[model samples]
Target chain A: MTAAATGVRATARIVARDDGRGGTSLPVLEGDGPLALRRTRGSGDEAHVMLVGAMSGPLGGDHFAVRAGVEAGARLRVGSAAATIALPGQAKGEARYDVRLTVADGAELRWLPEQLISAGGSDLRVTTHADLAATARLVLREEQVLGRVGEEPGRLVSRLVVRIEGRTLLDQELDCGPGAPGGWDGPAVLGGHRAVGQAVVVRPEFEDRPVSARVLGEGAAVVPLAGPAALVTAVAPDALRLRRVLDEALKSLG
Target chain B: MSRAALLVLADGRFPAGGHAHSGGAEAAVKAGRVTGAASLEDFCRGRLHTAGRVSAALAAAAVLGVDPVRLDAAADARTPSPALRATARKLGRQLMRAARATWPSSELDALAREFPKGAHQPVVLGLAARAAGLGALDAAYCAAYESVSGPASATVRLLSLDPFDATGVLARLAPELDLVADQAVEAARECVDAGVDALPAASAPLLEISAEAHAAWAVRLFAS
Candidate 1:
C-alpha cells in the first residue's frame, strides 16, 4: 500500500496532450525522484521523452514507480539515453519497479526502454500495466541482459499486463536467472544466450502480420503473439550480439 | 477423494490429446537446449517449479471451488505465449470430452457448454478433479506430473534419447514433484478468501517463446 513498505520509494509521472497544430506537447513533465525525463527534439507528430537515471542506478532494495499518459490525438515516444545497470544495494536484495501507462482514444505511444544490465547479486523485478482505449495504438519494446558485460547472471524478472478497452490483451511474466528463479538452460528459455527482448504492438482492427516464429539471424527469433502482438525473444552469445538482434527486431517491427 | 481418480487423470494415456504436443520440448531439442538426459532433467526441474508449479496451482484452485471463468483469466495472465495459450485451450477441450465420458458430472457438462471452444487445460483439469471427487492436492499432482511427463515422453521420440534415462530423470524429480504439488495446494487454499491473485504466476518465458517457434515448424512432429 505504501512505497516505504516495499523498499526505497521513487516515482515519476509524465502527461502529454495534443497541441492543436497537429502535434502533442508535454504539459505535465515531472521526474528525478529516481528517474528524470527530458524532452528531445523531434519532427512531425512524434515527441520523445528520454529517461535519465538520477542515482548510480537501482541498487538492491530500491523501488521505482513510473506513470505516463498520452491524451487524445497525441503521440508520445518513450526511450532512454542508455541501458540500466542494476547493482546490489547495501542490504543486498532485489530492486523492483512498477510502470503504469495509459493511452486515451486516438493516442499513440512507443515505449522502447533500453536493455537492462543485471549485475551479480542483483535481483530485479519490473512490471508494466497499460490501459488503452479502443482507438488507441501502442508499441512496447522491453529488452534485458541477464548479467553485466562479463559476469554471472543474477535474478531478473519482468511482468507485462495490457488491457485494451477493458479487455485483457497481454499478461506475461518472464524470469532470467542462473538458478532458482526459474533457472535457464540451453533449450527451453534463451538457448544459452544471456539476452532476451520482448515486443508487442496493440492496434484495434489490425490485420495479421506475416511475422511468426522465425529466427532473425544467428540467435534471434521472432515469436509472434496470436493477435496484434508480436512477441520477439532473441538471444546471442554476448551483449553486443544481443544489441544487434534487438536492432534487427526494431527494423522488423517497422 | 479417490486416488484412483487422480491416477486416471494423471495417466499419460488418459486420451486428453496430450500426446500431440511436446510441451515445448520439441523446440528446445531442436535448439540443442536438451541434448541428452542431464539437460532434459534441468529443463524439467525449471518447469516443475515455474510453469508446472503455476499449472498445479490453477488445478488445485479449481478443485477448491474457485470460479472457472476467473481462473481462466488468471491462466491467460500467467501464460504469455499465444501458441501455448492455444495449445492449452485445445488440450482443455480434449480433456473435457474424456471427463464427460469417464466421470459424468453436471458441472463438466456446463463447463463444456460455456467454453465450447475451450477454456484452459489447467482449469479443466481442476474441474475434472472435482468431478471425480478428488481434492486440491490430487489436482496439483495430476497437473504437475503432466507438465514433465509430456516432455519426457516427447523427448524419447524427438531425439531418440534412451527411454530408461528419461524415466530416470522423472525418478530424480519425484521429490521435487511432491514439494511443488504441496506448495500448489497450499497456495490454492489461500485463494478461497484472497481471490485468484493468491495463485502463483511463476513462468518460464523461454518455454512460451519456444512454443511459438515449435508451432511454426512445418516438419515438426509435435503441434506445439
Candidate 2:
C-alpha cells in the first residue's frame, strides 16, 4: 500500500547489533522524527526488524542506510515498510541509497522486498555489501525498474558485493542507459520487455536434484518454452505477487 | 571461416535461445551476488573452469570424431543441474537444425535423428565441429568462447555495466580461453584414446546453485 506522500526529505538509519547472548538489539533513527521501530526476536534464532511509517516525502535526493550485523548463531530478517522509489530531482535528477549487512558463523540473513522504481530522469545507485562466514546462509532479493508510469526508462546503475571471510563471493554492476548493447537491446536480454526483477538464495551446500526440481516447479510459469535460455514472466497487479513468485523461484533454486 | 572451421556454436539466432541466457549472471545480479566488473569476470572464469571446461572438452572430443552417445552421456553426468541439462538439450536441438542446414553431415543428422529429444549442446557442438572440419583445439576454443560470451554479454543488460567494460572483461579472459581450450583438447584426446570411463570429473557447486536459482525466477529476462 502507498503511504501518504510526504514532502519531507530525511535520512533513516537502522543499526542491529548482536548482544553476544544470541539475541540482537536494533536502534533506528529517521530524520529526527519520532522513531517508530519494532523488534521481534523469535525462538528459532530469527531476529526480525521492521521500520514502519519511518520516512515520507520526495526524499529530496536524501541519503539513507540500513546496517545489520548478526553475531554467531543469530539470524536476521530485514525489510522495509513499502516499495522505495527514487523520485526525480529538480537539479541533480536522481536519488541514492546504501545497505550493508554482515552475518557471522552459523547465522542467516534474508533480505527480501518490493521493487526499486526510478522515475524518469531519475538516477539511482544502490550498493549492498554482505560479509558472511563459511557456514552463514544468506538470501537477498532486489528488483529495479527504471522510469515511472508511461515515462521512458530512466538511467539506473547498481552495484552489489557479497564476501565470505574477506573473499568476494559475488560482484556485479548494472547500468541501464539509452544506447546500451546486448542484454538490453530489446529481444536479446529482456526481450524489449520492461520491469525486470531477480532473487538469489545462497547456502554453503545443498543437493543438486532437489534444487533443480524446486526451480522447475516454482518457475514453471516463466520457464522458456523453447531453447536453452530460461525465462518466465507474468503480468501482475502488485509487487507482492511478484515478490512471492521470486521467493518461490529462489527456494526451488536452493 | 574455413581456415579454422568457425562453426557458430551458440549464436543468438541459432534457436537454442542461448541469447536469452546469461548463464548464472542474471541470478547473481538479482541476488546482489555480483557487484562489479571484477566479480563478473570471476563468475565467468569460474564457469569456464566448470561448465565451460566440460562443454569445451566435449566439443573437442566430438571434433576428434569421438562417439556422440558417449559424449552425450558424459555431458549428462557433468551437468548435475536439471535446468542446465534441459537448456543444453534445447540448445543441442537448435544446433542440430542449424548444422543440418549449414553443413549436411549424415552422422550428425543420424545422431540428431537418433537422439530426437536433443543431445547436450557440447555433444552437438562437438559433432558440428567435426562436420565443419575444425580440429579438436579449434573446436574446443570455439566452444569455450561461445559458452563464456553469452553470459558476458548478458551481464551488460542485467547490470548495465559498460559495454566497453564488458568487452574488456571478455578480452581479459582471452588467456583463460586459451588455457581452457588446451585443457579441453587434452581432455578430449584422453577421452577418445581411452573412453568416457577414463575421463576426469570436476564439480562447481555454486554454478549449479546459480543455474537452479536463475531457473526459478518468475520474471527473469534471460532463459538461463
Candidate 3:
C-alpha cells in the first residue's frame, strides 16, 4: 500500500523549565506538527513528554527534524505514542529522520521512542546528535523492527553521536536492510535475525554500565565510553523480546 | 600515484598486526553464523558493504587532506562495539609502527606522538595511504579488503573449512569489493567540502554485539 509521495517536512521542539514549589509536575512547553509534544507531569521537577505523531506514520520522502532541550535544573521524560511504520513512497524511495537534543547542566532527559516498523522496499536514515553539559544527564533508547511478522524486512541506516563539553563520548551507526550489504545476513552480524535495538545512557552513577550489563544480559553488548557515557546493543528474533530485554538492561542501570 | 607503494602498504603481510584479530569472525563462527564457504561469502559481503565501506571512506577522506581529528571522531561514531574499538586501536598502533618504519614521514611521527595509546585502524590506514602517495580508492580498497580478509582467514582456522574453498570465496567477491571500494571513494569525495558526516555509516549491530560476547569468552583462538 503505497501513499502518494507527499513531501512531509515537520519539526517538533521541547524546552523544559524547572517548576518552582513543585508538589505536582507541570509541562513547560507544547506544540503541534507531524509530531507533537504532550507533557505528562511527574513528581517534583521532572516532567514526562510523549511524542504523538499527528498524521499517519511518515511515508516515503517524508523528512522529520525533531529538536528537544532540557533547561538547567529541569528534568524531562520523552516517549513516542505509537510505532512508526516506514513505507517506500515516490520521494526517491526513502524517508529521513533527524533528532537533536541538548541537555543543560543540572538537567536530565529520558528519551525512549517506540519501535519503528519498516516494510519491505522501504529505505530510511536516522541520525541523532546530542550535546551535553558536564553536569547534565541523558538516557536515549532507539529500537527498530525489520518487517512485520511473516513479512520481509526493509533497509535502515541509523547514526548516533553524543558529545560532552565538545568532546565526543559515544558515536555509532547501524545500517541494516533485509538483504542489503553490511552483513545483516551473515553470522557475524544479525545471524539472519529480524530485529535490533540500542540504548545510550549517561548518568553519573552508571559508570560501569557497559561491562557490568554484559555479565547480566544474555546476548547483548554494552560499551561504556569516557566519563558517564555508556551504550547497549542487541539483536533478537522479534521486537517484543528485544524490548523486554532492553527494558531490563535499562532498569539494571539504576 | 605510487601503485607499488599502495600495494606494499595494503599487503596483508605488511606485519602491521592485522593477523592477531579475526575482525569479529570469531564471534560469528561461535554463534554458528559461518558454517561453510557459502556462509563465509555472505559474511564478508555484508562487512564489505557496511563496515568495510565506512573504513574505506574514512581512509580516503584522510588521504584527501581532511583533518584527522574529525575523521577519528567520525570513525568512533561509525564503530559501536567496545571490543571492536579496542581491536581497531591495537591494529592502528601496530600499523603506526610499520608505517613510520616504511614511509618515515614526519606527519606519521606527529600522529604517533599525538595518539601515544593509539588511533583507530582505518584512520591510520588513511594517513598511511597519504604517506604512500596513494589515492582514496587505494586506501578504500586496502581497508575494504582487510575488513573481509581477517574474517576469511580466521574462519579457515575456526571451521577448518577447506583453505581452497575460503580463497575461492574471496576470489568470487573480488568484483563486489571493487564496487564497494569505488563507492567509498565517491562518498569521501562528497565530504571534501562538507563535513565527515557525509561518509557512509552502514553498521552491523550483531557484529558489534557478538564482539562483546567474544571478548568475554574465557578462551578463544583468535582475538576479536
Per-model lDDT: 0.81, 0.63, 0.80
Candidate with top TM-score is: 3
TM-score for each predicted model, relative to the true structure = 0.91, 0.48, 0.91
Task: Name the fnat for model 3.
Answer: 0.64
Candidate achieving higher DockQ, 2 or 3: 3
Choose the strongest candidate by lDDT. 1
**1 versus 3: better TM-score goes to:** 3
Q: How many residue pairs collide in each prediction?
A: 4, 18, 4
Docking class of 3: medium
lDDT of 1 by residue, B1-224 (tens): 66788778888889899999888888888877889998898888878878898999999999999989888888886776667888999999999999989989998888889999898999999999999999999999989999899899999999899999999989999998999899999999998899876788775657866676667777989888
Native-to-model Cα distance after best TM-score fit, residue B49 in candidate 3, in Å: 1.9
Model 2 lDDT per residue over A1-29, tens place? 12223222334455545557667555443
Tens-place lDDT per residue, model 1, A1-254, is: 22353456778889989999988899988885668889998679978899988666677788888899999999999998888888777754689888999999999999988878888888888889999998898988777787876788777878787877766666666677754534354366565677776677776655344455565654555655544555566666766776777677767667
Error of 3 at B14 (Å): 1.4
Native contact fraction per model: 0.38, 0.03, 0.64
Candidate 1 at B126: error in angstroms?
Answer: 0.9
> Second chain only: TM-score per model?
0.98, 0.93, 0.97
Q: Which candidate is the best by DockQ?
A: 3
Model 2 stretches with alpha carbons more than 4 Å out: A1-212, A215-254, B7-16
